[model samples]
Target: MIMKAIQKYSVVLLLLFIAVSIAGCGNQKEESSAYSIFYINKDITKIVKQPYEPVADITDTNAMIDEFLGQLKTDPEDVEYKRVIPKDVTVLDYSVEGELLTLYFDKHYSSVEPVEEALVRAAIVRTMVQIDGVECLTFYVGDAPLSDQSGNPIGVMTNDSFIENPGEQINSIQTATLVLYFADEEGSGLIQETQEVHYSSNISMEKLVMEHLLEGPKSEHAKSAIPEGTKLMSVSVLEGVCYVSLDESFLNQDYNVEEPVVIYSIVNSLSEISTISKVQISVNGDTSGVYRDSFALDKIYERNLDYVDAEVQGNVIEEGATEELE
Candidate 1:
């Protein structure tokens, strides 16, 4: 009887050891899926990240993103960390294309203070990009991509877009030489001009080019091609195509600038960037219609020197458009 009892005890020990080993394996799986969720500090100056592990087995990318967004809106147990999404702001929806994730928020999102807004963007981008497939994110207030008070689109944002500074480093100054195209004296041809500009580092190069074009040409020989009060809704480059979206104001054409001149002005200017090979302009994300009568907004445009004035090629342009000609 004692021998039988001893054998039974040995069997129980083996079973217990197997259970413990299975539990250890489960914990390891959870750790592999763990990621950091970022939140703003109570002072609203910067963001803090906290490691989070999901309670359930969530292998779907959409489900994982949804879980992360829910966490961002939830108040952390730690008093030092605050919820990044403002109470008034509501994430209406989200979608993912390739590696880009876009979050659509209600109009109230625009009400976030500039400094706090920068932190919020940083928190979201840093948190979301941790997902296995997502690499970048953008916020959309209603149909328009998020913009600053000056009406320039914030464009696509990645982990490097914001610096963690209490004072908000989004306004940090950086300089770039912009190659811009404007109409000639007759408003029938493109005249390229170069400008050295000090702009916010947060702004993308594509949006910067559009902003300067809207601001008009600084040279005496060049004229404004974009219509007045045209707000750039958004600008982004993917697969060699620069996608440009503008407000309805862009449809209000300056008749003095011929159709091709106005269209190619934007195309040739943006094409100066090595990454951009084609440009597609749209009004409020609608590319179905034409810009005027001939230039279709739906069509993708390559750099067209056909409308560029011959004089522009020979003139010393400070090396902006001239280099692209070569």
Candidate 2:
């Protein structure tokens, strides 16, 4: 009787150990499960997030990208989002370096319609950058780098690159009023105008204001200080100073305008941002250059109210001058 009882106890112990081992294996598998990020278009203007789908566990980054792209070709299991990548396009190869990921695609990438280009690019960029350790992305189609409309190389793009505005998806957009300074019709002083702007969440407010200023003013009485055809290379803020980089065309001026008027127009306009205290201008990324023959471009500029034509009680008047009776 004792021998039979001992045999039953050993069998029970072995069953318990086997059950524990099976549970541990199951947990490990669950922890190794992978997820793929997808971008869904919001209102045809912006890209928004969708729930990530679980993918087959893969260790290699290239293989992981392949699986993600393959999944993107098919309709997502969840109905809330639709696939943006064209089925004809295929990923030729990819490489990962530090924080940047480069994707090489076949000729089908260029075959995407012009109207759908932005949407497709946004979708791909937004999806890939979400992965850990990937901060920027570059694209190549058949050994040729992607270029923008102006033929400028679209270099490494971060999450803030493609989206005009980055923020929560709201039903309506919010706008802010801006006081911009422009060259007066007479070309003697700066004219102040109030502009209503739709604030962009993806871009810095100062950059948006500079872009609008570059577009020139709508009012017939004011003129743009920035020369026509001048391209904005980049805009960035470091510490309290806002740095604006422009192309060579900024030096070309058809009308006779003072250096101060042109320089202060940008300085004062950008200084309206609460965080910015000064403005620095650069040409083609070079800070040391001459803007015409008058002002040295290397120096930082502060806001000068003397050049601005101030507004008084709904009437426009020259600074330090009283309104004369009409």
Candidate 3:
């Protein structure tokens, strides 16, 4: 039944790609799920989990994505902890080919302006695949994964911990380090994390930052907003602050209005999850200078630029603006 649904809906849902559906909230609860359903991002493909939703031992995928955004809201100031890198982004279909889960972004996804090709590859893939159960991930923008503008394969990295696992079975647990492990046909095990990577497991710091308005340690806000296949890349703890990095494609997605909701939940979740008091965020890397469709956003001359290459383009203008020549 699952395979049959994937084959049928995969083409139809993808082919008739609509921009946005404006449904009335009054009728929202009463409406059938088919009509009430939303497409997360145009390039992203989401097949709703009907009978068998993905079950995790430690945390469900939904909680992870939402908690990330929540942290963004509570601690917006902590967001700029790391120098933000700018990567060109696009949303693409997500598919599982054997043991690997491939996340495809738009075709221009690989052309990052700030980080080099090597750093882009490591940051995007390693940060995202750190989630439980996802052993290996291949990133594609459009039909092509990690390609430059000219359609050349550039940033593809295989997981060091990949075991040749296949096929899915029932949900069960293997205890080792408060982890929820599931078995695949291949030899590797999917480990789920319940407690935050903090000193204490009993505390709900992770829950507070995640904004679990509900009973469980899940995110109420961001989960309902972005489409599925969205993953939290990395939350770094440095000197009493949490620095979070995210997939570049996150900025290119389609939300009805106020897209920063995605970011807010992430930052807030981080503030709540761990002992860190502050949180900072950057999409793919670029901070104040990030623009979506390419505007001539000049780099502001801030006092604390660490790299020292802060110029309009790349030149160092020691004096003020030069006079126009005839």
Candidate 4:
């Protein structure tokens, strides 16, 4: 009877040990998951996070990077999102120092077309920066740094480097000197103001100047020539001519300002850029209309300083003229 009781107790203990071992294995599997992956969208314009069970031990930066790059080579159909990296491109290696992550790829990385090159870099940089502790990124093919179509170094990139509009890669802060034209307090003539503006590279200087013109003048002596609520549809410079397209609000005559002042305000301001010699104004991309009765919107105009306020300078010149006559 004593032997039978001991044997029964031993059987119970073995069964309990087996059950606990299975539970331990389950817990270990759950704890290994640590990360998720991101991939580029179909347009090659944006990054999309992949839906997957968290990866295990992603704290290893090198292994994490390798896994991310490996996903980029997956077929679009095989994955939920499209991959931006060309299949021919391979990651040579990667290194991390503080917040900066440097990625070296094979020569195929630079072989992308000029237009797609920026997009590729944007997709890669954007996806990589999503990782924790990665604040800046740089790309290289072998020992040489990657460059854009214009041969400018791709440079270190941050989260703000890629802009949605224009899809261009630029620094977060770029300084430009803009010569803007606004109306005088009396609304009789235009006034020229030189301002130093800091803007993102993703935006063109012409667009920035147009936006500032709509914001009105900082000085109390100057006023806005653009009508209130005027929407700038687009602004671009090509072959030394700047094209400015505005919404219907620009046609409203409620401002009580002369048509030429409004017309020349845009013309002179955009023409200030050395590359833009003239400006063509349009309403909603239609250049067939006219402003008031005399100013033709269909025609391109050069910078006209005739409507500018020259009273102060005129007074100085008049005083000199009087002295000369005397």
> Which candidate leads in TM-score?
1
Order of candidate numbers by lDDT, starting with the best? 1, 4, 2, 3
Over 274-321, each residue of candidate 4 has an lDDT whose tens digit, in order, gives 899988887766788678788888798999999998973354446657
Worst 10 residues of 1 by lDDT: 16-25
Per-residue lDDT of 294 in model 3: 38
- Counting clashing residue pairs in each candidate, in order, gives 0, 1, 41, 0
Q: Give candidate 1's whole-model lDDT.
A: 0.74
Residue 303 lDDT (model 2): 91
**RMSD (Cα, Å) of model 2:** 19.9
Cα RMSD (angstroms) for every candidate in the order listed:
19.1, 19.9, 25.2, 25.4
lDDT of 3: 0.31
Off by over 4 Å in 3: 1-222, 226-229, 288-326
Top-scoring candidate (lDDT):
1
Candidate 4 lDDT trough over 10 residues, lowest sum: 16-25
- For model 4, state the Cα shift of residue 27 in Å: 58
| C-alpha TM-scores of all predictions | 0.67, 0.61, 0.25, 0.49
lDDT score, residue 90, model 3?
35
RMSD of 3: 25.2
In Å, residue 283's CA in model 2 sits off its true spot by: 3.6
TM-score of 3: 0.25
- Kindly report which residue pairs in candidate 4 clash with one another: none
Model 2: which residue pairs collide?
A: 166-202
